[model samples]
Target chain A: MSRESIVNAALFALLIAVPLGALATDEPFIITLATRAVILALAAVGLNIALGIGGLVSLGHAAYFGIGGYAMGILAFHAQSYTPLFEGPFVIEGTKLMPIIWLVAICGGALAAFVIGLLSLRTTGVYFIMITLAFGQMFYFFTISWPAYGGEDGLSIYVRNSFPGLNTLVPIQFYAVCFVLLCAVLWFNARLARAPFGLALNAARQVPHRVEAIGLDPVRLKLVALVISGAVTGLAGALFADLNRFVSPTMFSWQMSGELMVFIILGGTGRLFGPVAGAMLFVLLEYLLGGISDYWLAFLGALLLLVVLYGRGGLVGIFAGKARNHD
Target chain B: MTEPVLSTHALTKRFGALVANEAVSLDLRPGEVHALIGPNGAGKSTLVGQICGAIKPDEGRVQFLGRDVTEQSTRTRARSGLGRTFQISALAMEDSVLQNVVLGAMGAAGTVWHFLRPAMKDLTIRQKAEQALERVGLSDLASLRTGEISHGQRRRLEVAVALTLSPKAFVMDEPMAGLGAEGTRELTALLDELRQEAPILLVEHDMDVVFSLADRITVLNYGRVIATGSTAEIRSDPEVRRAYLGEES
Candidate 1:
């Protein structure tokens, strides 16, 4: 195996070992922190598909993330209250089933992404970034003002959602679910990176006209990438809401969108486990440095500058190697 | 007469007040190199853009294999076998040479949407890309990143990409540009062979290569066809001599 493969393997091992060790030591909070890292990494992985492979720098991903969080909150809220989601329209009932919530979250995120992508993709570079940020802010204000599902104060579920054959209330059990989902998404991302769709998307990112001259529509490719990315990030949002037993308009804030991008940049933009490494590092720094000062983000900004200037690739690039042959 | 593989009729394009191309018509017949030569600011690229569906004409129609494709997207025309190479090499610099060719093969096969199977391992796409690379004498450089390759190799790689389309006609924009004498000689020979696979509409500044390879010559001056003839006829035409060849020769 190549050095990158070895590093990826080791990273996965460390991710698993940390949580399991936390479980043994009865550090439920540490396990919760690990779960947060996994979910954030999962969200970053979604952004990586568009930002890394497709070369789209979207700044509105929190809209999808918030949609997912609200998807979980609304459904479980209705299920707990014994009220139909709507009086008419075939009497849609809210259910706390994890799989169903996940399905709803994915579809919600994907549908929103399709509509947003259609409009945002018309502009590119800095304009595209501004448009996405605008969309994110739009969602943030809408959620705060709506007031139907707790609005700005946010909604909270008294108990975590249910998963069959496991008590999700247990920190280790919940972490396992998020871990497995992260692994599956990572595997899917890896497969996509090698697939024909990925090859065209990568080429489109580098030279769109070259892709067009060879008979592929670059915009369509990017739209699909954005949709997939949104769906994955949405799933992570659902898990994040469940982990905290809370959902908020803050989930849709622009800062959350920027944080997801940070995870990818810190790890390595296009590397398979770059999001994972970046997320873990971000969490580790938060845990370690959040105690030291209220301005930990200033340090992060400095580090991000260093990565942008000299590091070129990020943590994975430093530890493993530059990706050879688009690996 | 054999039907022309590609043609444009009364193609005109305007940028506000200035007209880039006006009433320009051209055709490439089967198994022939139809060379388009003109001096700078002559609107050859503009006319080419119209034919390749990159530029929309204010007035005109582009027909490929007899179908009017004036409104088709650039990719649709490309997929319909209107292969083109850029004047400047437009290639995926980050992709390996094989991956770049494979991308073209994937485009030609219309299998770019296939999401599960690894693209490089797909035998059909791999073989087509390999065959195109072999045709351009670039099989040995297939594994190298495209950016790291020499200028001449990138030019040939461009031809390889177009070839994977299984083109009915080629719209080449200065395929000989930036090549050394030996590189130019090699590409000239390869392009001569490529005509047997598909007719070529060549745009070039190299008069010797143009004269040697062109079965027919169309000269453009200010977006208008100044002359259309064989090597002997164009060589003797006073208008062509005064407009273009006089300054260079």
Candidate 2:
């Protein structure tokens, strides 16, 4: 086994063990915190498909994330109120089932990513980043102005929706759901990075001319990656909304996009489990440090500076010693 | 001309005040190496660019496989059986040498979108890439990262990459630039064998390699073709001697 793989395994075990220990001690807040880390990490995993592997620095992923959150919030809200989602021409019923909500969130993410990626992939480097950022802002303001579903005030679910054979209301049960999904998405991202498509996509990121000469359309490949990326982030967004039982335009904010990127960078760019490690560190610091000072973010910024300046591979690099192409 | 596999007709390109390539027309016949030699800034790169669909010719037509490709995208040109190597190496440095060659073969195999299965697991692609690597004597280094290879090895790897396409015609820009004497000799020999597989349009500054390997030579100066003929004829052309080859022995 490679050192990186061992570190990855250790990370997985540690994340799982922490919540279990918290569960034993009856510190349910710790379990909730762990669940937040998993959900945020899952969202970053989605971004890594484009940001890390494809070298697409998307600043609008929060649009898809927000869309996912809204899907969950709107559906559960209507289902609880016994109100139809659509009226007049055809009856569209809302659903409280986890699987159905997941499907909806994925589709919403896929659609948004497809449209946005189509236009954004035409430009590259800083232009691509800014274009995506602009699209994200567009969604942010659109959501705030769309007043029907609480708009700027946001929508709240009275209770967490049910998953088959599981009471999602239980903190530990919810954490398990998020944990399993995180593992599945991480596996999927890893599989993709090693696939033929992934090889071409990575090549495109480095040298687009070479990719073109090889007869592959770099833009098309990136578009597909963006859609796949958005789908995963969207699913995480839905889970996030369920965690808080609330959805807001804040989900679409550029700050949310930056934070998603932060998770990937903090762990290590392009590493399979980088986002997960980054999220754990991020959430832990936020929790442990929030207790110390109101200006906790100042310390967090300094830590990020230390990592960027000295650590080449983020947190994982510090532990695994800069394993290349591990993803 | 037997309808040369690749042909440019009256291709003209200008960058504002500079005429990078002017009314340049050329052809590459099957199983022959046609070397394009010129001084720096003589429009050899521009002409190569026009042929490979990298730069749009202001006025002209390019045909590949007997079909007009003047307006085709670079990827489209490549898909239509054109292979290209950069003047500078354009490789995915982090990927294995085998992976780089596999990427070179991606367009021909029509499997660039297969997401679930690992590319290395695809026996067909893996073997094809390996065969190309073997031809270039880099098979032993297949699993090594491209960045770990020497400069000369990377040049050979570029040829190995082009081979995977099974290209009908090759557009190689300065394939031998920056190689040592030994590296140049090895590449010359490989390119000699390579022409039997597919015709090559080789652009270079190395006259010895050009004279030894090229079946036909074309001389370009200041965006225009000055002469095109067999190696012997080009060697004695007074106008060519005066214009570009005056410095060489």
Candidate 3:
């Protein structure tokens, strides 16, 4: 195996062993922390596709992330209240089943991403970034103004959603579910990074006119990447809402989107597990620093500055050595 | 009686008041290098852009492989067998040479959309890209970072990129720019061989290489085609001598 793979393997082992050991010791709080790390990592992985490979610096991914959250929130809220989502010949009932919520979340996220990308993909660079940011703000304010699912207050779930053959109420069991989903996403991401689409997308990021001269449509490739990115982040959003047993308009906030981008850059922009490492560090920092002082964001900002300046590659560069240019 | 592999008729493009190309027409027939040459600000780049689909013409048509493709995108025209090389090396600087060539091979026929299997695992794209690299004598440098290669090698890589498209005609923009005498001679030999694979629409500033390789030459000045004829024919044209050939120091 390559040096990077060895590092990746070690990271995965540490992640697995820590949570399993916590489960044995009956530390529900530790398991919860692990779950939060995995979910945020999952969300960042989605963003990494567009940012790292497609070179799309989307500032509005939280639109999809929050759509996923709202999908779960609205579905579970209706299920708890025994209310139909819409009045029609066929009543649309809310569901507490995890699979159903996940489907709804993916669909919602993908649809939002498609629409946003359609309009935003026309412009590039800072314009693209601003348009995406505008979309996120649009969703954020729309959710805040709409009164249906608690408006700005947000909806609350009475219980965590159900999965087949598992008691999700148990913290470790729920963590296992999220962990498994994260692993699946990681696998899918690795496959994509090596695939033709990924290669074309990566090349397009570096040189779009070259890609076009070679007969591939760079915008089309980016659009597809955006939809997939949105779907994955949306899934993470659904899980986050379940973990909190609540979903708020704050899920759609711009800060939430910036935080996701932060995870990628903090860990390493292009590396597969960068988000995992970044999220772990971020959560730990938040907790450790919060205990010391409430001005933890200042510290995060400082660290981000350092990474951008000297530690250009983030945590992965420190561990795996420098990656070659293809990444 | 055969149709030209690539042809543009009365193609016109305007940027507000400046006419970049006006009633420009040219033909790239099979097995010949049709060189487009002019002084700076003479609109050669603009005319090439119109033929390559990078710049949309305000009026007239571009026919490629006997089809009217004036409205098609650069990508559409390319996938349909019109290839292009940029004036500046427009390579993915971070990728390996093989990966860069693979991009050229993979873009056509919708094979670029394959998202599950690794591209290297697929023998077809790898083999084809390698073959293109071999044609340009770049197979040995396949694993090298494209940015690290010498300028001559990068220009050859550009040719290799277009070669993978198996083009019926090629639009090469200043492929000979910035090359030394030796590099220019080596590339000229390569183009001599390449014209058999596809007719080339070469835009170049190097007069010697243009005279040696081009089967025919077209001179442009201020977005208008001043003359189109054999190399000997253009060398003797009075208007060409006054407008461009004399201006070349």
Candidate 4:
């Protein structure tokens, strides 16, 4: 087998082995941590589309994540209250099924990203980064002040949403669902990174002038990638909300967006499994450090600074040597 | 004849107090090689930029193939058969040489909407890109990454990219700028062959190549055309010598 295939197989084995070992132990803490890793990885994968391939440093991905969570929380609340979303021509109610909630979350996040991307893409460089961050803050503030869906106090999901042919409340089964979705998204992300749009997106990142010279509009291409990225992350957010059985204003915070970026950097930026590795390391560090001291975040910040300054390519790059320009 | 293929009328561009191009008017006939020569900062590159839609002329018209395309964007102009090679040799360095040519051809092919469809898999685009590489003697190095090629080879790749568009008119800015002696001969030969296929507006600094290759030459100094004539006439013109030729001494 080729080196890449061998590496992939080994990775796949580790993914199955580690999770299976966690399941065999029946330890709720380990299972829950594993589930969180998968969900957070999914979110990071979304940002990778824009950040890795498109070269768009969106400091506002948390906005989409929060939007996804809110979609789930708001729908569940309205459904529990037995109130229709709108009393006009059609009555839109919510469901407790995982797929339905995920769909709403993805669509909500994608729509918001499309609108934000349209405005943000008008500017480039630092302006684009700042505009996306501003838009994200706008959404966060709106959610905090809206007061309709528990506002600052947040909402509690009374029960874990059901999936077809499974008792989702069971920690193992729920972890399995999250694992499958994460794998599916990773597969999809891999395919997209090799696709034509992905090529154009990478080309735009390297030299936008060349992309434009080839008659492809860079703005439109980036916006499409951003929307797709936001949708994927948003779907993960819905699953996260269901997993935690709670959603709050903290979901929309810029700190969450920074954490998402940090996750990608920790694993390896632009590498296929970078987000996965990053998410695992991030959560493990948080868990370990949180146990040691309340000021763990300061340590994490110092570590990230050192990585950014010295280790440009994160852990995967260090282990794998240099990644070929795959895009 | 045939609407002159490409024409510019009193094209002027200014950056604050500096005039980059001052009412530069020129016409390129189909199947002709027109050379634009000037010393550094004589506005030859700026004129090429305006013609290629990279920069807008302040108060003039640019007509390409009978249409006034002065207001069009760079991509629009390229799609309409006006191709350009930058002086800096701007090829997609991450992509293979073949892929860069493929991208150029795909630009003219149609709107590339389907991302999943591999662009290189198209038989026609592949054939055209291969043909372009062959014309520039780069067929052997087609699969090499653009960044891996030698500087002269990259220059040829840039020309190959422009050729893949099957352009009616090519605006090449300093095609021989950084080429060594042997590389310059190869490029001169390539330009000679290209002149048979389409009109070329060659912005060049190499006098030997320009004098030998150009059917006509226009010399600009200080953003204005100082001389326009046959090679023999340009060589003998006292005013042209005083402005540019004497400076070389």
Candidate 5:
């Protein structure tokens, strides 16, 4: 195995061992923290599909994340309140099943991403970033204005959603759910990085005109990547909402989008488990530093500056040495 | 008297007030390198762009393989077997030399949408990429990072990428730019053999390579084709001399 692959394996092992160790110590809180890292990492993995592989640099991924959160919130709210989502059209019922909510979140996120991509993909570089940020802010305000599901204050779930055999209320069980999903996504990401689509997307990102000259549509590739990225992030948003048992407009905030980007940069862009490593560090820093002072974000800012200046590939790059490049 | 593989009829492009190309007609017959030569700012790039579907002509038709493709996208034209190389080295510098060719093969096969299967493991793409690399004599350097390759190798790599498309015609823009004498000689020899695979519409500034390799030559000036004839005829043409060759020789 290569050095990077070895590093990746060690990272996965450490992630798996964390919650297991927390469980042994009877610290359910640590398990919850691990779950938070896993979910955040999952969301970052979604963003990395566009940002790292596709070189989209989207600044508005929170739109998809918010959509996922709202999908879960609105459904669970209706299910608990014993109300129909739609009475006149066809009596659409709400579902508290985790699978159903996740599917809805994915579809919703994909649809939103498709529309946003259509408009934003027309522009590139910083303009693409601005347009996506605009779309994200648009979603944010739309949620705030439309108060049917509590709007800015957000929606609250009476209980956590259900799986077939697991009590998701247990911290370790929920962590397992998030952890398994993260692993599945990481696998999918690795496969995508080696796939023809991944090759085309990476080429498109580097030299769009070169890709076009070679008979591949760069914009179309980026659009597909954005849609897939959004869908995955949406799934994470649903899980996040479930963990908190609440959904709010804060999920769609620009800061949330920035945080997702931070995770990728911190771990390593394009690396399969970059988000996992980044999220682990982020959560750990938040917990450890938040205990000391309220100026934790300042410390993060300094660290990010250091990484951007000296750490070319972030934490994973430092561990794995030089980038693998073509892999 | 054989039909041209690619032809442009009175192609014109206007950038506001400046006429980049005006009523420029050209053709690339099978098994010939039809050189498009001009001094700097003679609209050679613009005319080439119109032929390659990168720039739309204000009023004209571009026929390829007996079909009118004036309205086609650059990618559509390329996938239909119109290969192209840029003046500057437009490569994925971060990728390995072999990966660049594989990307081209994948594009040629229209398999870029295949998301589950690994590209390297695909025998067809890998084989095609290897073949193209071998053709360019870049097989030994296939694993090297493209950015680290010699300037001449990058230009050959560009041709290798275009070759993966199995092109019926090539629209090469200044492929000889920035190459030394020895490098240019090697590339000229390679391009000579390439004409058997596909006719080339070559836009170049190197008169020696053009005089040596081109079967026919088209000279342009002020966005217009001043002369189109055999290389000897073009070399002696008075208007061609006055407009372009006057500065060179």
Candidate 6:
């Protein structure tokens, strides 16, 4: 195998082993934290497809993430309450199965991303960033006001969603599922990055006019990347909801979107495993700092500012040097 | 006689109160090099933009391959066989030289949506891209990052990208700008060789290269064509001499 393949494999194995080991210790705190890290890393990987490889600075990934979580929450509530989703010519009901909830979450997120991308891509640069953030805020406010599924109080699943063959109530099995999903998303992301669509997307970012001059439209390519990103992130959100057995408006906040970007930036933009490293560091710092002080987030904010200004490549650059290959 | 491959009629553009291009009319025939020369701020770039559909002319029409393209997007214009190179080489710096050429070919192929297909694995696209690089004498540097290549090589790569489209007409804006004598000589030879295949609308300031390579020359001053004639005629015309050639003389 090539050095790159070996390194990637080793990283993947390490990610799985670390979380599994933590769960084996029978410590609820550690298992919960590890699960959160794995889920957040998956979300970061999704954003990286667009932001890192495609060079799209979408500030609305939280909308998809939140939608995914809400799908799980709303479905579980209706399933437990024995209520139908809608009453009309045809009745729509909810299910508590993990796979079905994941599918609904991903599809919903992708659709939302498609609409947001269509409008945001009309402008470029900082305008695109702000527009995405605006859309995300709109979703956040809507979720906060909507009273059907617990509103601002949030919705609790009561019973965690089930997978086909495994006992998802077991922390280890649940963590394993999350781990497998994270790895799958990462693999898919890497494959997409090396594909022709990814090449055109990157080319559009670097020299859009040249891409156009060669007969490719930049806006269409970017929108496709955005949709893929949203779908992947939404899948992570479903996993997150299952992990917590709850979903809330906090999932759709700008802070969540900023954190996702931070994960990519911390690892190194456009580098595979960058999001994994960044997520681990971010969660670890939050855990350690929260134990010590109430103002830990302030410290994180300062640290992020420094990283953005000084350590532009993030931790991946520190260890791997500059990313020689495209993500 | 067959219609010209590309034509611009009464192309006029305004930026606020200033007229950047004023009723400029031009034509490009097949297998010929038409040079547009003028002093600084003569609206050559503006005309190029209008012709390539990057900017719409306020009061004129651009025709490509006998179809009106004045309202077409830049990508549509390119798909219709109008290829252009920028003044500053606009290559993807992070990608390899081979990848850059392949992107150009892929743009022409219109297969950018094949998300699962590896671009480098496509033998046909790679072959065409390599052939384009070879034509520009850049095959040896194919694996190198575009950022690492010499400025002159990047400029040549720009032309290679335009050539990869097998365009009916090539619109080059200052392809020789910032190149040394050796680089200029190399590009001049490449342009000469390309003239046998497709017509080139070259907007250049190098009078020496212009006089030697251009079959016909159009001189613009203050957004108006002051003279259009053979190189010999342009060089001797009293008005052309007084307006532009006087400075070089």
Q: Across all candidates, what is each one's fraction of true contacts kept?
A: 0.87, 0.81, 0.85, 0.42, 0.87, 0.76
lDDT for each residue of candidate 4 in B1-249, tens digit (9 for 90 to 100): 456899999999999999998999989988888899888999988898888887888999999999999999988988888878888988878778887887777767863555565666778878988999999999999888888899999999999989988888888988898899999999999999898888999998888998889987899999998888788888888888888778563
Q: What is the lDDT, from 0 to 100, of the residue B214 in candidate 4?
A: 92
Better of 5 and 6 by lDDT: 5
TM-score of chain B of 5: 0.98
| lDDT per residue as tens, model 1, A1-327 | 888999899999998899989888899999999999999999999999999999999999999999999999999999988888988658899999999999999999999999999999999999999999999999999999999899899999998999999999999999999999999999999999999999999999999998999899999999999999999999999999999999999999999999999999999999999999999999999998898998999998998889878877888998887888752
Instruction: Sort every candidate by DockQ, greatest first.
Output: 5, 1, 2, 3, 6, 4
Q: TM-scores of the models, in the given order?
A: 0.99, 0.98, 0.98, 0.95, 0.98, 0.97
Q: Which docking class does model 6 fall in?
A: medium
Off by over 4 Å in 1: none
Categorize the docking of model 2. Answer: medium
Which CAPRI category fits model 4?
A: medium
Error of 1 at A178 (Å): 0.2
Error (Å) of candidate 1 at residue A163 is 0.2
Candidate closer to the true structure by TM-score (higher is better), 2 or 4: 2
Off by over 4 Å in 5: none
Top model number, DockQ? 5
Residue by residue across A79-106, what tens digits does model 6's lDDT show?
A: 9999999999999999989889999999
**Every candidate's TM-score, chain A alone:** 0.98, 0.98, 0.98, 0.95, 0.98, 0.95
Q: Which residue pairs collide in model 4, if any?
A: none
- lDDT order of candidates, top first: 1, 5, 2, 3, 6, 4
Query: Per-residue alpha-carbon lDDT of model 2 for B1-249, expressed as tens digits?
Result: 376999899999999999998898888999999999988989998899889988999999999999999989998889877988999999989888989998887767889888888878888887898899999999889888889999999999998888899999999999999998999999999999999888999998988899989999999999999999999999999989989888475
Cα miss at B229, model 3 (Å)? 1.1
DockQ scores of all models, one per candidate: 0.80, 0.73, 0.73, 0.52, 0.83, 0.69
Q: Which 10-residue span in candidate 6 chain A carries the lowest summed lDDT?
A: A318-327
Compare candidates 5 and 6 on TM-score and give the better one: 5
